[model samples]
Target: MSAQHAAPAAQPLRPARAPTGSGAIGFVGPVLAVLTIALGLVLVRDALAVAGVISGDGWVVTVLDAMNGQTRTGWALAGGIVAALLGLWLIVVALRRRRRKALWLRKAAGVGIRPRDVARLARVAADDVDGVLDAKVTAGRRNVNVDVRTTGDPYTRDRVREVVTARLAALAKPPKVSVRARPSSSTSGGMT
Candidate 1:
């Protein structure tokens, strides 16, 4: 008389897209938008003044009059050059690619690890190596650099590199690891 119940099927996971930095577009896009709006407003105001909808001459007329009243050819030329350079800079920024802000964790859905955390992890791994007295680590999108102060001979940079690399193996794309091992100041007779 008893009926068996079937278990519900597990849902499949979707892969996450890697994140990218905002690049130059982040600042330039909003700045250009604001500048466009300001220019449009100025033009509208000038049109309204021409139609007698406003009392005084608009900003464009005032600027043109000031420019004409002053013998400022040098100033005008400098301004033009600056504007041209800015336009070229904007074009370059628009074409440049955004740098990555975080690395993806292996086999984890929608999870990311920042470079600071990666460096901390690498430092921990390096500290675990035999004879390592202290470790400093810096991680970028594509590289991890480790500086290790050691108890003295017997500890090598290769050992630190190997340990750090192994610890970071869980990252989706583990950065290239580099290690520099130095003897402790007390043992090496120099300040580290």
Candidate 2:
């Protein structure tokens, strides 16, 4: 007699996430690291001086003397304020989400699309309309603004919206499409 084995449970897949760029941490982290290293190096130098392995009063002694000798001044206050502001800025940057570099597409879980590429796709769709002479598209995460130059056909705007909407159907959360149609300058015999 053969023993029966039980099947393992299936785990649901996690939703796809768009890329959030490095943001301020990318710049601030290195600066902070360098400052820390410099401080460590200075402390080591000061230790060497204290041990009679180097010359001079050392930075720590000089700083301590200066702090003990001087009263709080406007410059010191200003520096403190500047440092506080820097800390606040760092907190804001660290806590806030980084800017998204691409948008998710419904075509596939691994697929992503950039705003510029979305604009290009919308422009191509707008241009496919019968009377459209030119198309310009500006795309964001939730909006696609289309400006079309057409052969003075009023219906061109509707056609552009329809075509662009259909083209962007594959997007997981498709942006709202706005189409503005204008008469083509070339067709209107305007200045070159």
Q: What is the C-alpha RMSD of each candidate to the true structure, in Å?
A: 3.6, 4.0
Among all windows of 10 consecutive residues in model 2, the one with the lowest summed lDDT is 183-192
Instruction: Write out the backbone clash pairs for model 2.
Output: none
lDDT per residue as tens, model 2, 30-65: 877887899999999999999899988789999899
Across 39-142, the per-residue lDDT of candidate 1 in tens digits comes to 99989999999889989988899888877867758878999999999989987997798987889988787788889999999999998998898999989979
TM-score of every model versus the real structure: 0.79, 0.79
Which ranges in model 2 have alpha carbons more than 4 Å from their true place? 1-17, 186-192
TM-score of 1: 0.79
Best by TM-score: 1
In model 1, pairs of residues that clash are none
Cα lDDT of all candidates, in order?
A: 0.86, 0.86
